[model samples]
Target: MPAKTKEQKTAACMALAMKRGDLKKTPGTPAGDMAESMTEEQLVELCGSKVKKGG
Candidate 1:
């Protein structure tokens, strides 16, 4: 499912970056853990289509 809040969408973006090796994954953190446990597709799904370039 898509993220329900901005925070959740942000987290998914961070996780996606980590999963794609674009960002360093800090183990034990929420986004890091999500990156470890979820697939790229899953992260993208959580990120949703409404994401924009800036806030």
Candidate 2:
């Protein structure tokens, strides 16, 4: 699925990273909450538009 909003992109990227062992999920925190607070630049820097944009 393509990701539209920053939240969706962040989620997709994070999921991919976790699946690839690039990132680890915290014990008791929602990844969405962390992604929500991230700056757009930071998000882009981390994921680099790897997540496809939705229509």
Candidate number achieving the greatest TM-score relative to the actual structure:
1
Angstrom error at residue 6, model 1: 1.0
What's the CA error at residue 51 for candidate 2, in Å?
Answer: 8.6
Candidate 2, which segments miss by more than 4 Å at Cα? 26-55
Q: Alpha carbon lDDT of residue 32, candidate 1?
A: 92
Alpha carbon deviation, residue 37, candidate 1 (Å): 1.0
Q: Show the lowest summed lDDT stretch of 10 residues, model 1.
A: 46-55
Tell me the TM-score of each prediction against the true structure.
0.81, 0.41
Q: After superposition, how far is residue 50 of candidate 1 from its true place, in Å?
A: 4.7
Per-residue alpha-carbon lDDT of model 2 for 1-55, expressed as tens digits? 3345677666646744554457774533445444456554555455666545555
Candidate 2 Cα lDDT to native = 0.55
